[model samples]
Target: MSVRAAELPSRDALQQLVRAKAGTAKVHHLVPVHPALAPLLPDGGLRPGAAYSVTGGALLLTLLAEPSAAGSWCGVVGVPELGAEAARSAGVALDRIALVPQPGERWLSVVAALAEVLPVVAVRPAGRVRDADAARLAARLRERSCVLLVCGDWPRVEARLAVDEARWEGLGEGHGYLSGRDVVVSVATRSTATPRHVRLVLPDATGRLSAKAPGTGPVELRAVG
Candidate 1:
């Protein structure tokens, strides 16, 4: 199935459907992440019922890949530029993912409704979020044991991940095409005073994430306009 913007469901309808489908299955405390990204997380995986602030679309896709592959439902809200091909290439199971490209004034409601059934939901707020609204959502997430990945700022988050540096490879003398990106990702948790950094091939030549090998020699990089 393709990942495309879907029509929003009514809150009552969505809740009833979720209740019917959810049954009484228990949710795991953590969701699996890419092996390369395990070390960066405080729990070695994404903790259920918690919020994480993430920067970069690639990184968000990376986070969803493992969970979706494991048969978990995922959703993305308010990201109109989310490329379906890129998501597929990044290993996301498009059949199990929902895309809400534009939530407009109902962004929060859409996210909340999705959280009822989706184990993992990502959203880029369309406007500034009020602290009270965030707090209410946080409570709902905890109650449902759902994981929320916010692309933009949140009033509170279990952890924050940001790409500190990035460089593309596979170009030589302006001849070869861009193939992969190497990035320095910084992970910060509320419990830690300083953030931890990890270098990774965000998307290697094969379009999958991997830890950057140690002691790799640096090559001259040309700035791209």
Candidate 2:
């Protein structure tokens, strides 16, 4: 008996299943991640065929900003709340950043499609991403020399960038508007035996990422009556 098309499964579902059954392959060549994050990575950047999980929602914009400014096309899927102003402020070239905020039930298909054209694609999985699907995406990424930045959890990731601690520098006991923040970044990779880490200000008072360690000196925050 023949099964109905709806029962057969969609293209995304098949890809995920196929990936789960596929074997791993080696990928060479790395793309420059954000300048601040580069030093923390063993390869100093993202590998074409690997997946990465990162904490800090704001970090998504900052991380993509790097390659985007360098003329690489970038896309964001599944993060509807991400704002254009924030992305622009973070150094992402507005013209090169593609935003798909919502893709409904076709999130995976959308990601797959973007991966084909964009060199960098940042996606926050709307739901649990099966290992099979993740693997398929990774394999595709490697083939296309693309960087897949996953905002949420994914199976068998190459590395994970997590924020251990974050404290604002401009907050006062009674006054001052929010200014800069100091954050500690922890890095872990499945391929490496050990992990790397760093501490820096994502956006200091000047509204720019500090290339070096964060400033320690305390400063007064403006008070308004």
Best by TM-score: 1
- Tens digit per residue, CA lDDT, model 1, 1-225: 765546667788889889766634433358999887788887788887889999998899999999999999999999999988878888999999999998999999999999988999999999899999999999889778889999998999999999888888777685777678879989999988899998888887767788866333336677999
The per-residue C-alpha lDDT of model 1 at residue 135 equals 95
Query: Which pairs of residues collide in candidate 1?
Result: none
Candidate maximizing lDDT: 1
TM for every model, in the order presented, reads 0.82, 0.80
Task: For each candidate in turn, give its C-alpha RMSD to the true structure in angstroms.
Answer: 14.2, 11.2
- Cα miss at 155, model 1 (Å)? 0.5
* Cα-based lDDT for every prediction: 0.87, 0.79
Cα error, residue 134 of model 2, in Å, equals 1.6
Please provide, for model 2 over 122-179, each residue's C-alpha lDDT reduced to its tens digit, 9 standing for 90 to 100: 8888899888888898878877777888888888887998877889876667767667
Clash number for each model: 0, 0
